[model samples]
Target: MITKILQYYRGFVRARIVSHSPERFLNLCRNHQIILQDLVYRDGYYECQMDLKDFQRIRPIAHKSHTRLFILKKCGFPFFLYRNRHRKVTYISCALFVIVLYVMSLFIWDIQFEGNQKYTDDVLMTFLHSQGYVQGMKVHNVVCEDLEKAIRNEYEDINWVSARIDGTRLVVKIKENTGILEIEEKNYEEGDLIADKDGVVVSVITRKGTPMVHKGDTVSVGDVLVAGTLEILDDSGGVMAQHRVQADADIILERTYEYNDYIPATYIERNYIKERKHYFIQFFDYRFQIFPVEKKENTEIITTKNQCHLFSNFYIPVYYGSCQERIYEETEKSYTETEAKQLCERNLQYYFKNLKKLGVEIIQNNVTIKWDVNGCTANGTIVVHEKAGKLSQEQQVEETMKANEYH
Candidate 1:
């Protein structure tokens, strides 16, 4: 690839040789250290490509080998410049573009982040901006080591961070601490565990409190599942003393989620007519249109912009691309019964998928879809088993005690 690029930068040519001693001609050319590429022999003639400099030297060798050489084609940058020598404005514009790109390369144009899960791109970018490490800042102003350390310090979840400048882009890669961090257990005030939703109790495992509800019991929201107070019974079945503690337990419950959705029978569909192509160039905040675009009603404009870049990660502020104006007509349409049913089923499946994401185990789905002349309706319930318990301040209960019981 390097050699081909060098050849193009200098110049190259394809020449045809008609000689009886083709083997001798090749040997002489090799002896002179002239490299020939894509050599082919066809119909008693030899054709090959050589650099322009090598082509010039091959003339003497061709004479010595009693061969006739004819230049078939000229290629490469030198030839291109010579052909366009008369166009002064084109050359001047190209030179100015190169200068502009060189200037743009001195500053950061793009910021990219990778290997991020807990922190999103916007969040990370916002942090960087707060630290004065934003796009369009001078490349020299960015200290990679400082940026890496700052990120790791800012986000406790991120254990490792790598920041580097690739061309004009600043790339940051981070590895989040996936392992759960252990927290010191603190003595919490006495509280009771209550049901946050109406459900049937599936199971209860009391760790540090008295269980108030058993399995198969139907409970409503705000009902206490575990009591924070514990009572000590005497041999005669009398309350000897009472101990109050915070409730701690794992409780599972089966709950039902009502699902209801309806879709209108009529919808508007777009009918495409034709598209008009437009060209534009943008430099920083200013944009220039190559051609005038006529304003039309009921037309959608879709634009694509491409930033100027010399290589990967080396982006410039200048952007150029095309815009397509899509002309379309809206038509009113009605959904068929089959289509409505399918749409309703799709919505139902999507709801179930969201429920499963929240660690809810689906037990049963009793959804029914009905299609009528007006529209489609899906109404039913979904049964799921999920963890159920929320901490609530314990209600103080007054108890009568004799002074002798303390002794």
Candidate 2:
């Protein structure tokens, strides 16, 4: 039966062609032993169909002619089934996606905050959540302007703030308050300089206090410079009150450290592969299912969960992503002291380089220590060169240190 249908379709198949010269068209087809079927003459072209056999017969001449032909072929059932599968999935998925997107458009899945440096993300999110702008809330149910006004009224440290909905996450940007303290300058006092470390005196700069030593003066740790002359003969030939000042100086020292390590013969390593699967119900972004979700110990292995939403089409997610985690763990064997010291030295040098930025110059450095039967430990002292001047009280954020005042 299918063969007969195909034969009929082939016998009267429809097509179109263009030919400028009628005589040439007739001669060309005749030369190729082909027949013309259901011919038309309009717009310099013919519209018609032809049997495969007839078309093949004239195919040779048609190849040489300036004219062109287009044939309308019938679709077979296999072709129809194949196309229908794609169209069906697309149509059904699209239809479901639309309804789902509309419903999901009303709900919120995530919230985010940006442009916040002073406050942690958790803190900002907590504040936002208390304001009714949290995840899983209906997106269309809240007005963000009112929320911002409320937040500004509640938090004095915030100068300016704004909230926006980007897909499922609400991005809250904020500016923090910065104001200088109001203080009046007072009468000044002079102080002395004391040795912070055991080193040779290099040089000292006394702003208000008198200097005690010049360059190349050796000093022990805790030695004082710039004596506070309290009972001094003034120009009036009388004893005058002593004044305190800060004796500032730069001191550098040499230091050393070492590390010990033990080598292990075997090591343990862990590897992971990700398997992703997603399911939907009613083609909406309302709910989801994840397998093997039971919480357990040895969570050392971290599992990250990400969620995305689609408000436009169910098949294409438009919302930003979210992630949750589970921890994974692996232990590797240890190495010998030489290997450990190399590793420790690499890290130690990295840290020491940062300390140099604090204005301390290193005159010399040495590292000597190792761990074998037990863990490694190191011990060393720093020696710097600097001069001393009179000291004063320096007030700072944490604690106030007094120099000449201590004496």
Best by TM-score: 1
Predictions in order: lDDT: 0.88, 0.56
In Å, residue 278's CA in model 1 sits off its true spot by 2.7
Kindly list the per-residue Cα lDDT of model 2 for residues 44-146, writing each as its tens digit.
6667655667765765566667666676664444445555775777778878978976766676666667677778888877877787776667778767798
CA lDDT for candidate 2: 0.56
| Alpha-carbon runs more than 4 Å astray in model 1 | 1-108, 113-198, 207-209, 216-249, 292-295, 390-407
Q: Count the backbone clashes (under 3 Å) in each candidate.
A: 0, 42
**Mind giving the per-residue lDDT tens digits that candidate 1 earns over 232-286?**
7777677777777789999999999899999889999999999889999988768
Candidate 1 clashes between residue pairs 3 or more apart in a chain or in different chains: none
TM-score per candidate, chains pooled: 0.53, 0.37
Could you report the Cα RMSD, in angstroms, for every candidate shown?
Answer: 10.9, 15.8
Name the TM-score of candidate 2. Answer: 0.37
* Candidate 2 wrong stretches, greater than 4 Å: 1-202, 212-268, 273-287, 296-332, 336-338, 369-407
